[model samples]
Target: MPRNVTTAVAGVVITVCAVAAGAGAAVPGKLGTRDGYEDAGGPVWYWPVWFPIFAVALAATGVFLATRPAVHRPAAAVAAVLAAQIAGRAVVGVRDWFNADGAGVVDMSQHELATVVTVAAGIALAGTVAACFAVALLWREPARGWAALRPRSLRLLVAGAVVAVGVPGVIALAGSDAIMLAGTVALTAALPWGGGLAAAAWLGPRARKVTVRTVLACAATTVLTFPVTMLYLMVSHGYDVTSLFS
Candidate 1:
């Protein structure tokens, strides 16, 4: 893949990591509650909303990594685990919805639904942790196939992803009882810009070699525009960000 394409893929990794991390971050405190519907539910079951992006991003990352001059076995292993978690979560999210009714409408409590969602999300977290390990393993030796980053730069990369993903969430949650709502809403808001920035940051130097404009365009396309389009559905149509199967 081209440098721009690779950078774009990195943006997706940022998004997925944010989604997975954000979800994992939220679940610990609220995992076992019956009332963990809104904020908790959002993180527990937000996969339906983010899954397509996650899927596409994962595929892109795999392709990009494979084609890189060197391959980091540990990172590849971690990526594979992340892929499984996401894939499993996607499947289980659908399964929960299907269980709602054999062939008709079935009313279910948010609590009941949350149990299933949280369990699946837990599995997803395992996948993400595996990916983190991969990132770590590769970082120790970039030639092993890990994308190289200066120590200071790697910290900056992580910090950037967190802020870009978290700031909007804090704003959204300020007055709401629904932390889940806050997270989902904020994430919806954050994705485009956050993902874009992450893409640019990760690929910026690599892309510099390819052409700054092309790099920027790819970053913008994957990060900014795409998330905005996704967020628009929720804002304009009253889309529920937490509906597991929607």
Candidate 2:
């Protein structure tokens, strides 16, 4: 990625971290049912929206660390984003700790929840970065053996293989109530880019690089993942699949 592009991406990370932290800092008391804000039947189910936020941020950080970017210098920008995430989480943790209802053990437990979640994210990022620093890194663009296949089959196999892994996130997001959204959305969204990149990179003699066509197939599969996720989540929830059309 270009330096400018890296900066923009870093800015996005910082912005998201800041916004989430700033929002959490606004809580005047420990979050729990004691405030009359929630109950056992609600969507919270022992996990709040922050769980997804942390999951996604950490996943992206790991992706960066595991795959060496085309340009190495911009890798440092990931650290800045990590810092912002930690700082923001710290603020939320402190805010929650002081404001928690000490007499209520249920509410008190959450004081460290923010801290623990961010710590996991930090470990994921830090560990990956350390590994990248130590090992012979891979470009993460093209998968091995896909391009070696005959030209005619490139579209069928190359795109099919990559798109198969990330189908559920697309579907889960469509589920009823608060929605089954998660930080894992990268799975489906990745098809259009990952498939296209793999197809473009396998420029060896046995095969020619195909662009938009491969992308279209990947895109179709990407669309398929969404409905699949929705169907699974709906059926699991006991929702009538046919009722959606009604």
Candidate 3:
């Protein structure tokens, strides 16, 4: 099969599996309920908020792969990660179901099940972000307009710093807890793409084209904000990163 076709198929498969996993986790059942969930008490990061962001990312990845077939290698890597995450969850769920007690009751607690689901979701998120970085690197190419831009390193670094500082500032200024939470989720979802852009810019030729350079600069800024935002949440808001899966 052609590489482009393979990439598109893989993307579609990953997106479907990701959506299924998210939907399954969202269901209200013994596996989904928070009651007695091991990581339930960690933080306020809800599945409703996280799952949608995850699904969107997966969908976007699929679209990118299908539209930009040149990115097949990186896209395939990402799809593999997502598939592994789904497979891991399935394996755990099956094991729990089959290893029931003497009376045939499932031995896994609600918390344990929830934890497994959360962990799987977390893996997907992380894998997607990493894949974005890889794709950006693969897409890196020089543009003619980038030649006039002086001190590219300094400019990129400065742009990254601004993003790191600006996101939290904007959220704080929003002055509503709900808005802040929403902003954080949005930023988290966007971080990987931003980081990928940044990587491309940093790695691309100095005299690259104007549009490509601009995108790379923007991407760098966006990627840099994620860690800063997380830090702000941890120090100022007492947000626990580990609770993301919980």
Candidate 4:
């Protein structure tokens, strides 16, 4: 099979896995309880929201890879966005850790905490891998890519920043916790990826070529792994499948 075709196939597989994982994680537990399954500190709908977004991004990346000869720009942009999302998630995790109140601590056992920590570490590692891939991909032709992307990257970054901050702020002002939570989660997950892609778009436009195909494959794997892992954790902790719309 052609390399791009292979990449596209892989992307499809990853998207399917991500969607499955999200569906699995969305399974609800006993009434008024999550069966000790914490949402990484978010609302019940978090996984339902998270997985679909991830799948869409993965699918888009795959399509771009399959159709485009030199997908360096778009791929790098996607990588950047993923990196930013990872960073944002990390920040939120740390902030939540510090801000956790006494009741929160009481609710989570040592094992649960350990599980959360392990999942977080896994996510962090995946993010790091994705970021590295993005950097390497961009550096393959730093001067050329950078030159082509520099002006556009700046504009994209600025626009992404504004949307990232502004949309959530507006949602918060609306005063619905559910809407605010959903908006915050969506933006936090999406904006960073946008910004990162834009920022990295202009980098390494004239660097030496590396095993881009392999790098892209690995990156896709890493991206898909996260949701799978999360699904496993949720199921292991006794979460049951529930309707996403309900």
Give me the overall lDDT of model 2: 0.39
How many pairs collide in each candidate, listed in order? 4, 2, 5, 20
**Top candidate (TM-score):** 4
Superposition TM-score, candidate 3 onto the true structure:
0.38
Which 10-residue window in model 3 sums to the lowest lDDT?
A: 40-49
Write candidate 3's Cα lDDT for 131-154 as tens digits: 443344344345656773443455
Which residue segments of model 2 deviate by more than 4 Å? 1-110, 127-136, 139-169, 172-182, 185-246
Candidate 1 per-residue C-alpha lDDT over 1-246 given as tens digits, one digit per residue, 9 for 90 to 100: 354354345434534554554354233222223334444232222333344444455555555454552543322432433444353443444454445323323333456455555655554554454345434323333452543453323543564476566775566656766564545433332443343334334433433222223223333444555565566535433357668466
lDDT of the candidates, in the order given: 0.43, 0.39, 0.44, 0.44
Where model 1 places Cα greater than 4 Å from the true spot, the runs are 1-50, 63-106, 109-119, 126-130, 141-166, 169-174, 185-204, 207-246
Worst 10 residues of 1 by lDDT: 207-216
Candidate 4, run of 10 with poorest lDDT: 206-215
Please estimate how well model 1 matches the true structure, expressed as its whole-model Cα lDDT: 0.43
List pairs with backbone clashes in candidate 1: 38-180, 39-179, 39-180, 72-145
What's the residue-level lDDT of 105 in candidate 1?
30
**lDDT of model number 3:** 0.44
Candidate 4 ranges with C-alpha deviation above 4 Å: 1-48, 59-72, 94-106, 140-154, 157-194, 197-246
